[model samples]
Target chain A: MPFVSIRLAGTATKDQKSAIVADVTQSLVTRLGKNPAAVQIVIEEVSPENYGAGGQLLADRDAPKPQEDAHAESSQ
Target chain B: MPFVSIRLAGTATKDQKSAIVADVTQSLVTRLGKNPAAVQIVIEEVSPENYGAGGQLLADRDAPKPQEDAHAESSQ
Candidate 1:
């Protein structure tokens, strides 16, 4: 049995999740010759506040959007 | 930065999840010398229906409680 777990920021839609499950299962089946029925996939959605990348919280990094700031300044 | 993702059957409580995150972080800190703040842990809970082990669905395995059935038979 092969179990695959995916963790990402909580922004994926239901369709995206389905696709991930299918793709991961397919990879295991094709590469490792695992039975499709025995392949399990779980996707965990983490809030930006709970996710840290490169020693910085995703929430903090997402708060200051440089592109948005530039756009606001140009529109002013 | 170390990211750890755990996938398990969906039976764990909030306290269990907290302990898992703390322990995983501590392990990374002790073994890999990674910054505690930079260690990210994500726990994904999968329903028995979606979890497969030994080529059988967990839901199916859980349905037949052999011990419980034996006890029921003994009481009859």
Candidate 2:
């Protein structure tokens, strides 16, 4: 059995998910000559809070800087 | 640190998830001598509609058979 796991930093629409499953299945079929029937794929949408990259959580990395927020407030 | 990702075809209960995390953590610790605290496990559940097998979506494969439905309707 060929199992594929995809972890996304954020969510995807149902259409996107469907397309991904189809594409991955096709790729495996083309490359390995594997049966599409035996290919299994799981798409995981991970929240930034739970995903870490570059030694820090994605949420912290992507969050607006405090100074930037203060600047915006001051400008307003 | 060892990271493990598990994909399930359907949903799991909280107790099942907790047990799985604990079991996997222990396995890494026993086999690889990795620290339990450093072991990170992510469990992903995929709906049948988003999963494909036998060259078709699982949802489609498991759907009610047209012949069965027709027989039921005729009997009714």
Clashing pairs in 2: A37-B54, A37-B55
Residue range B40-69, candidate 2, lDDT tens digits: 899878787667665555766687778988
Residues B1-76, candidate 1, lDDT per residue (tens digit)? 6777677886676556666666777778889898887787666677999999999999998786689888999999
Q: What is the DockQ of candidate 2?
A: 0.41
Interface RMSD of each: 4.9, 2.0
> How well does candidate 1 score on lDDT at residue B23?
74
lDDT of each: 0.75, 0.83
Candidate 2, superposed: residue stretches over 4 Å from native: A5-23, A44-76, B67-76
Error of 2 at B3 (Å): 0.9
Model 1 chain B scores worst on lDDT over the 10 consecutive residues at B10-19
Best by TM-score: 2
Sorted into a CAPRI-style docking class, model 2 comes out as: acceptable
Per residue, candidate 2 scores C-alpha lDDT tens digits across A1-76 of 7988788998887677777888889999999999888888777788999999999999999997799888989999
